[model samples]
Target chain A: MQLRQLSLRPFRNFARIDLEFAEGGAVIVGANGRGKSNILEAICYQSIGKSIRGARDHEAVPHGEGHFDIRGDWQQGQRRHPCRVFYGADDGKRVFLDEAPLPRVSDLVSHFQTVYFAPQDVALVLQFSAQRRRLLDIVLSQADAVYLKALQTYQRLLTQRNHFLRSLGHRGVDPTEREVWDAQLAKPGALLRHHRLLGLVEIMPDFARQYDVFSTGQETAGLLYADEVIESNPDEIPTRDQLEATFRQQLRDGFEKERHAGHTLNGPHRDGFVFTIDGEAADAFGSQGQQKSVLLSWKMAELRLLERRKGQQPLLLLDDVFSELDPIRSAHLIEMVEDFDQVILTAPRQPQESLGDRYARIDLE
Target chain B: MGPEPLEDLVVAFTRLPGIGRKTAQRLALYVLKSPPQEAESLAAAVRAARENIGHCTRCFHLTERGQELCHICRDPRRDTGMICVVEEASDALALERSELMRGTYHVLGGALSPLDGVGPEDLRIAELVERVREEGIREVILAHNASAEGEATAEYIHQRLDGMTQVSRLARGLPAGSDLDLADRTTLAHALQGRVQF
Candidate 1:
């Protein structure tokens, strides 16, 4: 999907601006604090229905302003969709596809797809397991609606089950309620584990190929879904029933342990995603550059999966990340990115690498 | 400024569900401009309804004051062996409107939601269990909504009533007259899962 025109009203630092994007998309060059990233954030906010920077809706509204509105026309092949998102202090957020109002914000996710890459995404590999899980979740959620629904259901059940477990620490909570929550949670939990495992399995081959492209194929890279219930066999996908049984058994056996912890101690919520280089853990054995390579490969693999699943090339939003990469990686990244129809890039200044003339350049003061 | 009583009246209107301050003020002004008899009749009707309505002893459904059993429970022709359990009194009424079930109804006050501090003891689960035991119920059809809390409540009740009587839940699928293309993926998936052999 490609954005044709974007108009932001009182959003972030921009009081008002209208951008007409080219077929190759545009690069916004500016000094720091000139809202270059904010433009990317506004574009991403339309796709995901919230700030990718994790800012609240009210925060996007400028100081002394009561509301913000973003309007854009997105093109996918021959069809063009007019999208509008309006947020008010009084009326909350409303999204429209074409001219009709979307009943739910989640409905808008599949309408527009974006793969947002920023400089901080390097933390996906070096930081906590949650970051990797979130990346996997975002990719999978945008690609598959069933996975998104299951994820929402799993999160809700996990919250309720944890709340009930906490109440078990005190009096007046029925012990049998544990069985109720277990039965309720097992289906979605197993589904989440299944999808996460399948996602890694499907993406691992491309992930390794992308890593080889970046690393000169010297060492073999691998992705692992570190799950206790289902064996991570890339050759064979685990059935949801297999996952559900093991999940139920784990919940039963770990009840006492969970009670001691005052919350859930098992299931996919605690599952680990590990990146391995030459059969060794990458975070422990690899250098910082190697970690960033793994992250980049994983993101490219995500983009491929999105394209394969949705049958559309997702809009790639690159935010101030080109300058952070070394010359070799940046050159290779540019080579890979040139194949895409639309690419939105931001930088502190025009990068040394000359992006081809297909990219429309815009400078902000 | 209007008098304190008018402000108090607006406040009272706002106390009701889904009434905002603006809506409350509008209602207060509308009431003020209306005839005196209209306000008196409205007040008398609210007072009479509050005084006359009470819950049935068995099902917890709204019944006339001093009634032991609701009209459904008192009907001799209705099947006493099967009880359709629902999450709310309104749910029971909805199922009754379908005219499909010949059994009596059991209205659980609400579903079990521990996060909201609602437990089995807070709902009418114990009463339903007692009725199933003492009233010779053969089957309890669980008509709870298809929400997590509702499913948990149904499972809990099924556990409690294990081996004593058969328990079942309502079949969920596409709404009547809804086109298959219009069904959301989740609903379509559910309908596929619950599809019957024709």
Candidate 2:
């Protein structure tokens, strides 16, 4: 799916902004913090009901405003569609597809499989495992509804469990009450882990191939799920039997401790995704350039996977990421996106004369 | 002018997960107006809780003893042959309200969500299977919510089990799109009692 037009009202620095996209591609050019990222943020908000920068709903409102609104016209498959998202100070946020209210944010992901690249994406390789896991999640969630549902359920349980833990010491709750939460938390948690392991298995080969492209075939990349319960032994990845047994044992052992401490400590929240280059941890050992290349390869693999699965190219949002890379990497990125049906790139300035005339630029002041 | 302590309090509060600036200010003023002893106790409570509580070695549940086993694991009356699986410990408590499940439980910590980058390896799935095998569990009930990830997680477990033992899922009594914990006690109890074979 590709965005054809976007309209924003009191969103970020844009008081009332309307912009249209060409059939092929559009380049948004602006100085730093001149509402360039805001425009992209608006698109992301309408598509996914959240900001790429992790802005809260109220934060998305202009500095002095209490409400923010975004509307987008897009083409998915053979049909043209209009989608809108509105956030208000008094009321909760709402999403509309072709003017009809959606039941959930996951419904929006069904319409548009968007892959965004921000400068922070470089951190995918260098930052904590959560970032890398998020990278995998955004891509896999769009591709599979089951994955989205599992994630939602898992997170909801985690929040509830933590809340219970927080209240345990203060509230007059029974000791047995904690057992109930343990039983409920385990089922989905196990299922979530199963899905992640499968997703990595399915996407790892593709990730490796793309990594080779970005790394000039000098590095071999691999993704591994690292957890005390799942694969404690590097030589023998624990079988499902072993993993489940460990889970039960851990819960059994921790029951009284959970009540005493008022918190659930074990599970996916503590898990990490391990990225390796030639059997070495990437985050600890990879250089800045290598990290960037790893992230680019992962994102490119995401694009290819979505295109293959959806039978349509997704709209690509590149948010001022070009400045972080060298000219060669920038050129490689440009070449990678050349065949996309729609690409929206934000940069400090227009590309040099060498980029030719394939892209249309829009200036934001 | 000196730094505005009130403003700093508001900013700090806003940094929390859900608290906004306005709520933060309300909280700060409440603390400021409270008795000195109360404020000191609150401060002491925060530090004491963080330092005293830690994960149980056996179940990974938070505790103060730093012991290997939790209370439930220590309970001899609970059914050891049956295990109710869930995303977090809170679900275990919600189930306990029904008083229908007599068996023990295993907390996996989360459901499989590939998009959010959560996977089986992130959760406690392997440990769950191990618990089942080592404990001689006769039945494993998959109690994840009825969502895509929940179903996928159940399927993944079913595949891994490979008929080592019977595995079932919580029945579809809860609303099509709803959370299990949010369901009323009656609904949750019924769902658990009516679980179906996976």
Candidate 3:
């Protein structure tokens, strides 16, 4: 899916803005802190019903306003569809497709699988494994509705289980009451790990290829599904039996500790994905430039994965990511957008000398 | 007569679950004027339970002694062949109030949902299957909610128990998508009685 036009009303720094794409791509160029990122964020919000920058609904609203709305005309299949997202004063958020209310955010993912890349994404390669895991999850969640559903269920159970644990010390409450939560936590917990592993498998080759292109064949990166629950064995991936046995054992051993901690501890929340280069952790050893290359490669791969799975090019949102890369890397990144139907790039200023007449420019002054 | 102590009492009360600042103030005012003996008794009751009560070893129920099974699981008269699987221990109490099913239960801890990254490996499903295999359960009754995650969970358990034992799910009487904990006792009991083979 590709976004044709985006209209924002009282969203972030943009009080009223309407911009159209050039069928291929459009670049929003302005100085730093001149609301370029805000425009890109609004477009991403319109597509996913959440900010790529992790802004709360209230924060997405104009500084002095209590509400914000984003309207987008997107092309999917052979037709152009209108999608809208609105947030209210009461912190309520709603999404509509063609004027009909969407049942869940996953519904929107199928039609508007926009990929967003930002400077912070460098953390995907240089920071904790959770960052890379999140990168994998965002891509996989958009590609598969089942994975999204599983993720939602796992989060709900995690909250409920934590709430129950906190209440264990309350008077008249039975400690054994937690057994029920333990049993309930396992099902979703296992599904999450399974899908995550599957996600890694699907993205590994893409990650490797993108890393090679960005790194100029200097490094070979691999995605590793890291977890304490997976026993040290000859198996590359844990079997269903091994997973179940480990889950049961962890539940048995962590019961008392969970009760004391007032939260469930042994599950996917504790799981991470390791990024390795030549059998060494890349995050700890990779230089800043190398980290940026790794993240860009992964994100570009994400765009390809979405395109391949959905049979359409996804909208690309580059939020001030160009300024962080060298001219050559920036040119390579811009070239990748040629395959996408629509691309929105946020930069400090138009690269007039490099881009020339290739991209339509919108000055976010 | 000073408001200082009264304010502290209100804050403490508000810290309790489900109690708001207004309710906390009202409760604190009532307690402040109550007899000293009654106040002392309340404190003693709280401490007495904390020092004594513990989880049952066999059934994992909260009890004074952790030696034997919980009352429900220990009762020989209850049906051992039928197990009502649930996500929380409070659900067992909710089920018991109706007195509809005499069968015992096996809590699965939680349902299958992967969004927050929870998977089958995080819960006690293997123990449940083990219980079924070891005890030779006649039927495994799944009482998970009807939400997407809940349905997926029930389906996963059903697949796990394929050819191992007869598995069933609570009927759709409880509504198309509703949590069991929120269902009324009558509706919960009806759903339990009308369970269909998976």
Better of 1 and 3 by DockQ: 1
B-chain TM-scores per prediction: 0.91, 0.74, 0.70
Off by over 4 Å in 1: A172-175, A227-233, A279-285, B1-4
Error of 3 at B133 (Å): 23
Ranking by lDDT: 1, 2, 3
In terms of DockQ, which candidate is strongest? 1
Compute the interface RMSD for each candidate structure.
Answer: 1.0, 13.6, 11.7
Candidate 2 per-residue C-alpha lDDT over B1-198 given as tens digits, one digit per residue, 9 for 90 to 100: 225987787787789888876788888889889999998999899899888876545455555765566666667898888888887777887887788988877777877653464555678878877877788889999888765457567766766676788998876668778887667544676778887889
At residue B88, candidate 2 shows an lDDT of: 78
lDDT of each: 0.85, 0.73, 0.73
Q: Which clashing pairs does model 1 show?
A: none
lDDT (0-100) at residue A126 of candidate 3?
Answer: 52
Q: Give the poorly placed runs of model 2, Cα more than 4 Å off.
A: A163-179, A227-246, A254-261, A353-358, B1-198
DockQ of every predicted complex? 0.74, 0.03, 0.05
Model 3: residues with Cα > 4 Å off, grouped in runs: A124-126, A167-179, A227-242, A356-358, B1-168, B171-198
Better of 1 and 2 by TM-score: 1
